[model samples]
Target: MIDTKELIDSGDLELYVCGALPANRAQEIAQISKQHPEVLEEIISIENAYQRLAAGLAPDHNDETYAKLEAIIGAKNKVVKSPSSWSPYIGWAAAGLLLIASGYFYNANNETNEEIVQIEQQKEFLETENIEIESINSQYASTLQVLSDPETVKVNLAGQAGFESSNAVAFYNNEKNVTYIDIQGLPEVPENMVYQLWSLTLDPLTPTSLGTLPIEKESYNELLRIDNAYDTQAFGITLEEAGGADAPTLERLYTLGVIDKG
Candidate 1:
């Protein structure tokens, strides 16, 4: 079985069908095939396949190519006095026709390639649009869930002494332990400055830096998600340097609010 498979893979079968195999190798294969039915069957299949292929691609030179050239030559010989003069004209006409066909084929191929490139670009655009739609749907689902929760704590941070009109609201979920901030009431943040959030403890007056609020993002419902603190006594927003400060600047406090447990 191994020998038969090797013979088939090594192209010995094709050589055998074409009568190109040496007599000694051919005799050895004949003996091996008599002992193995599979080998004989493989050789038969290869021969049949080659025969069919040859038949399908058989040349039609007699009727198509040779016949046309013969007729043209006969006409030139009978009508023209000098063979050289008429022959050159016939050759030039054939060359001209061939050049025109080549040009048409080249242009058609380029147009096909352009259409394929356009289709691929449109496919990529559609995929990007679909991803954006999925992201929008996911954001809306999250915002709706947060808003509908009854146990959610909503705290309005009023403007501090100096910044009387600038304000914002923070929504904290007790069970999920997450917080969302609404920045619509806050003023525009300066390029070099950012707003920092704090979770404060009134007794002894301690503040833990929650993180800085992003100036740029508010999802579906104009709500920007932020950090959460479980035992927070109050929440505050202050103008700080790029990254944020360790402690809130007393004078730069923008909004302050005490969380009412009741």
Candidate 2:
């Protein structure tokens, strides 16, 4: 009700009980506490705490000793502590010690919170790095499987008529109907042009488009997989307009390799 916890934590309740709050503010708190159950409980709790502190700290008030001290002090040249003089010093000392201890704990708590935040950030960063490394390892394991399989056919596609310097290797798994093309040996395609692969049937000399190659390529050494299951007599690549052509552009054929079905 009206955030009793907030009011208590704000030290307003303590100030009210100690009479440290101004008269108008204290009266306002009293009025609010009368209307709110939680606020009333909190005010009672603060009053109880104040009573306990006051009981422990209140100086022993002995009227007979104070009367004797007053009599001694009245005789101008006598030494006597009137209790009032020493009580103020004791209260100030206690307050100073409490302030120092509170300051130390406040600084320690802030530093501990900062360290916890820093540790959490480091944990997140390490977890992200570990995930990336695991992903890379899984990729390497799959690549090894493809390279190690005897059924995996490695076809070397050499440079064609005009492009004598370019070459690429095609790894095909007929059982899986998958092909991983290694295009590292091939040069970069010109802007607005793309490399297209074809599954060719030499008897009919038909060239069926497999797909367009990625222009902004990854590391050339990495193989790019394609899902193709054609009974290809030959694998050929051609440079075509960016999105690739419906048929192979023979004039721009860059590489060709025949699969000897012996």
Candidate 3:
């Protein structure tokens, strides 16, 4: 779409509205006029100018013609006055009905304008929201590019212990390190329950619980984001009882994966 402000500033729009342009340009102007009310208003002003010029060029009528018109109008007024005197009640009734209809039409027009304004406001709000969503999507794309770099270490976590079949993958970066968990394979956590991740160091079998995954049952992209991952060893997933787990439950170990040394 062309910029409206630029189109308006171009003198071609004025020439098009004046009907001085070629057929193609005229068609373009007509399409623009249909799309933009301001363009249509400009066209109307140009048409009114043409009308006034044509009227000014017309032949003039003399004072005798004006006198004849006045005489005819005066005669008609007297004839109308006689009937009007006899039908004062009818005239009053018609006037009352006209007032009621005018009021009704005025109110309807006001309501229609209000509805149009509300719709325009809603459209503007939706457009702004779409822009914000697009911006967030772009940022996520950049984050994915960084996470999927060839140097980033990949880990496949497989379900263990109680939940034996569920699986997930985590991509971790050491330099500019971060962890992203693609948990689509994991089943939905029950109400008030969450999946807790653990970062493990193998020598003494100690683990750092890296917080819970917020369940998004309806999201199209079900991957969860975990940040600040300058990890010492392995990755593990456990079913935490509500909110999050303060410590990993070895009995509820849903998945585990050793980080690739390479």
Best by TM-score: 2
| TM-score on alpha carbons, each prediction | 0.56, 0.60, 0.54
Clashing pairs in 3: none
Per-residue lDDT of 72-121 in model 3, one digit per residue for the tens? 78732211111222233445677776776676676666666767776777
- Candidate 1 per-residue C-alpha lDDT over 30-117 given as tens digits, one digit per residue, 9 for 90 to 100: 6567547888999899889999999999975454565567677773222112222233344577777577667656666666676677
Candidate order by decreasing lDDT: 2, 1, 3
Model 1 lDDT, residue 94, Cα: 78
lDDT pick, better of 1 and 2? 2
**Candidate 2 vs. true structure, TM-score:** 0.60
TM-score of 3: 0.54
Worst 10 residues of 1 by lDDT: 76-85
| Model 2 lDDT per residue over 1-262, tens place | 2576787688888889888999988976875675467888988987888789879997887677866876778833223332223333445777775776576566666666766776777799999999999998998788778767876788889998989988888887777777788887677889999999998889769888999988875545468788878877789999999899998899999998887655
Global CA lDDT computed for model 3: 0.74
Cα displacement (angstroms), candidate 3, residue 91, comes to: 12
